[model samples]
Target: MTERAIVAGVPVDTRHWIGGRRVASPGTFTTTSPVTRTALAEMSRGTALEAEAAVAAARAAFPGWAATGRAERARILHAVADGVEQRLEDLAAVETHDNGALLRSHRRGVMPRVAHNFRFFAEWLLTLGRDDFATRGHTNHISWDPAGPCVLITPWNAPLMLASWKIAPALAAGNTVVLKPAEWSPLTASLLADIAAGAGVPPGVLNVVQGYGEDLGRALVSHPGVRRISFTGSVPTARRIAAAAAPNLTPLSLELGGKSPLLVFADADLGLAADLAVEQYDNAGQVCLAATRLLVEESVAGEFTRLFTERAERLRPGDPREPGTDLGPVVDARQLERIDGFVRRALAAGARAVIGGGPGTGDSGTGESGLHYRPTLLTDVAQESEIVQEEVFGPVLTLQTFTTEEEAVGLANGTRFGLAATLVTGDRARAARVAAQLVAGTVWVNCFFVRDLRAPFGGSRDSGTGREGGGWSFDFHCDVKNTVTAPKGWRDHG
Candidate 1:
């Protein structure tokens, strides 16, 4: 409602920000709006050259940044948080317009959290200190050192927020970084570069390169100067990056895809379960940790299904800019089609649709238009079916039944991905048992998607490679060095 935030339909700046300046590339690509299926802006396309330049800048700045005082680093981070808060509305508007995320969520959920990521890491860094312990022969000192130049690659689903997750910690730990945001949603990232510079982040300590992953991503991963890489996206892409980075032997922290499960027991509050089940369709179910698989106790399966389907039907799909829209369009046509294909394949393989099962009309008065898919719920879906096993990454939920606690645990852990899981049970013993049995990095007992900044967040098996949060994130961005020295006039006792 401010003039700067009047961004219902606008094309934002699309140039790269490197070394505290705007850098343009020869080739460009048009980013299309998922809400209108129209060209939003032509972004400057970066290639190996631009990526190399960005890396060189970061590498050059690494030594100075690493030696910066902890207090100064924390101060800069605080300033960055302050800058983001100042531009919160504008950034939220740009994200909703570029990524098709519901504005309501961006305003209330995403943007505010972006500032939190910076503030949390900044405050945490202040608590850190060198550790020293005495041994028989010598005293050992352990300290964390910066990982040097690092590349942060974030996906488009929650662009600014996810980028903040990587950028905040990397900088807090005294590493210079080159951020390559998904081309589909690079506007706010561009804005962030300016904000960081304005907040007194030294030139080259933080840079942004806007381009497709294939060109820029490969170059960034293999660059010798990039000491570390933190990426969040699909599993297949993570695998590719892992292979590419193997020759360099660079450290990588990948938070890849997920086929997370949500189990509802007979003792759970059925209404709450149903409500949370429908809420999984947030962001049109494009979240990496969305509850795609729903396991229910056989005794209450039918009742839960009925309530969930009713809630799913009432999900108000509309344009993301609309005030009351519950669901927005998918990121693009390809993703929307992919979601539909999954539903179709499941149905062909004998899954039953309890409610919506196809593309939505975008007429729910939520203001949605392009690339809109209905909130779908399917039952009778086999555990082995692709829809149930794979990461759908859309607003589609598959239902299955389990009679026993052991069966539910088996079903929940069946998927290769193990990013997250949720268990709804009133029985304290059952909650603890199932939570421990579920093979996920994070498990919510009788709740869904509640996260603490200090808690570790990542997956097991095929989901990801490392944990990141609070100290976990600090560890990833830093190298632990142990120093040992003999005390004056001391000798080995043993």
Candidate 2:
């Protein structure tokens, strides 16, 4: 059942993105749905005028929320996980509707992924490691203290899950958050405040502000009270956000774009390689970890191409909620234009369509009902081709063949984006060795885009800074302070 959201009734303000209860000013912004380009709902746009408002709310709540013991904060996150379990259906529907992800994956795949995140962070509280070092019985204990108020700017590709990536751990580590979801997908962010309330989180501890990047984001990033930021999006935007937060010296954890590679060696199971290739683009290749680059061994390139192309073309693109829908629409119109433009330029530069290289549609009328793009594949792309080098964040994938294992690794790491890579090989030793050499934060062998919440996930190089999940995320939200109490006769001066 698709949830027709009553924005006002959701307990969080539809007009405002929840600066906190008994709060929020008169200013607001209207977010339209990509499915219809019609008004979905209106939420607070949060201008710089409200900069004081957001900062005040976060500042007011910061001391109490931060001072609360880690156990209490972890309990709140546990409660959030429980609430997610109870309203999984509602939240899933909201995600599918607002973000246009295939319900099949959003329900079974993404939601479970989110549940795992909350659970993983929640479980970290138990047996939480504290840094204590001993030298000559002069114990030096390191205390983890919250960095105070935080602002999370999440992308539309996986708003709820990514927000959970920021939200769960921040809460677990005793940091209050004010997240601004992509205006293209504000519905779920709107619901987050309600979910937190149900989980017994106090008002102002979690806030959601919706507006365009130029305005609301500027306000949030430049706000004085915010001590840190956790963002997942594009490099350009990350740069801008980083610049804005610079003067304040606010720490940030940024997870920005990728042009990931999927290597299929001659020894890889052809059927499995085909399966991974096809599944890799199912999210309309919106995933930052999407295997948009296919590096195949020349010996088996033909077989891999034949099998993978067949699966890619056969994908039925339609309403994500519809049955048997293998792929759905892109996120919005601008993304559609950008993705298609990249594909066109690639073709003009001599690339050829391998399997699918067309457009897809969405729900009944209005061709632009939802942002939809066809699953496209291109061959004959050069190493320096823009499509190969740039982050073509769509269902468009490029196919290339490499002869040697060294060549495969070389081509895979050639990109400036070092977010993720995939290797499909049956030789366990070679696969392990290649996976090690690949310059990516995460690598999948024989599979792609498999995420475990307990794993330490992050990127290297320009893919942006800091790790999320596991113990690393806890540290991302808190700074360690060493308490050195001198024992008798322990003074170095003596």
Alpha-carbon shift of residue 376 in model 1 (angstroms): 0.3
After the best TM-score superposition of candidate 1, give how far the Cα of residue 321 lies from its true spot, in angstroms.
Answer: 1.2
In model 1, which regions exceed 4 Å deviation? 1-11, 362-366, 489-494
The 10-residue segment with the lowest total lDDT in model 2: 1-10
List candidate 2 stretches off by more than 4 Å: 1-13, 17-19, 22-28, 361-370, 489-494
Q: Please, what is the TM-score per model?
A: 0.96, 0.93
Point to the candidate with the largest lDDT.
1
- Model 2, 115: alpha-carbon shift in Å? 3.4
Candidate 2 residue-wise lDDT, 329-369, digit = tens: 77777888999899889889999987666566544643335
Positional deviation of 69 in candidate 2, in angstroms?
2.4
Pairs with backbone N, CA or C atoms under 3 Å apart (clashes), candidate 2:
29-45, 35-369, 329-372, 330-371
lDDT of 1 by residue, 248-313 (tens): 899999999999999999999999899878879999999988888899999999899889878877
